[model samples]
Target: MNILLENIKILAENENISISKLEKEIGSSQAVLSRAIAKNTDIQAKWVLKIAEKYPQYSCDWLLKKEGPMLREMTKNTDIYGLLEDGVENFKILTTSQKQIIESLQKVIFYLEKQDETGRQEKNKNN
Candidate 1:
């Protein structure tokens, strides 16, 4: 499979979502990804960027060059809000990478809470 398709599948798996659902979020044409995968061609850059924007865990570099891990490995020292060090008023000025990290962290938090909720339900059912 092409890196583009592989990346898309990887992103969906990581997000615990279906490819069609992910395509919707990424603003891709219906079946565009599937078609590309079937044809075994490179995915459009615009679609790649859209996926990257929605799910920053998928490293852009890895998507583009097939280098590094599929997901970005963040360190505890990651300066998620360092861009606001100058002032909070200019948070809009943060670079794309900084914004992506913040977004990715939000997604992670949501995913964890969902897992916790499911676990609690399962535990209650077992009782």
Candidate 2:
């Protein structure tokens, strides 16, 4: 089976939907998907991107390269530390003052969140 077709089938199966239904959801026609898959031709990047754009649950790596799981593993939380790590990774392009400002903002945000939590706890206790 064509990898693109395989991924599309997998996506459709996972979503409890049909290929035609998936096509409708993505604003594509039946002829487009069937024609490409029937010929085993290379599918267009836009088609793959459309699936990824419409359904972010599908793994692009799996769809494009057959390298990963069909569905993307969902992150359990919005990891602030990982975001800070990403900022550090891009720190080379930042100026000293820019870095200082980001650090200050992070601290401010942290402090405000802590204060909010404490206030909530106090209110709950009073109630």
Candidate 3:
């Protein structure tokens, strides 16, 4: 069986929701996940991130790698240091994909800023 699809099914079942409902909750198109699951194919990373964001209780690591418990244990007494550590870990996990996006956005911003500067210089010249 496909592990990612199976994990999604498990999470939906645990949440007492249908696959359709889970897809809707994660802002996925209808039958998008169902088709992937049916075909035993991989899901989009965006959907995975959406699922992780929408349902924090379910472990993303488990969904991706079947590594840990499906449901992450909540700790009421989590310290600031623990939170920071978790944040760093999450950042590291996202860095590879997110860094690409960030670089692309930065390039776009740089281009736009240069265009704006050029426009200002032309305006000044005309003035």
What's the TM-score of every candidate structure?
A: 0.58, 0.54, 0.58
Best by TM-score: 3
Q: How close is candidate 1 to the true structure, as a TM-score?
A: 0.58
Backbone clashes, each candidate: 0, 0, 0
Q: Would you list the C-alpha lDDT of every candidate in the order shown?
A: 0.67, 0.62, 0.70
> 7-108 in candidate 3: lDDT tens per residue?
898899999999999999999899989999888876666676678667766666677657778776645323334555677755554554345445534543
Task: Estimate, for each residue in 1-127, the C-alpha lDDT of model 1 and write its tens digit.
Answer: 8665787777788788888888789888788887777777655555765776676556765665467788787543344466556566445545555776666455544544665688789999999
Candidate 1 C-alpha RMSD relative to the actual structure: 15.0
Model 3 scores what on Cα lDDT? 0.70
Q: Which stretches of candidate 3 lie over 4 Å from their true place?
A: 76-127
lDDT (tens digit, per residue) of candidate 2 on 1-127:
7665787877888899977788788888776776666776655545665676677655555665477676655442223344456776444433443454345345434544665688789999999
Ranking by lDDT: 3, 1, 2
RMSD of each: 15.0, 20.3, 14.4
Candidate 3 backbone collisions, by pair: none
Could you tell which candidate, 1 or 3, scores higher by TM-score? 3
- Say which prediction, candidate 1 or candidate 3, comes out ahead on lDDT: 3
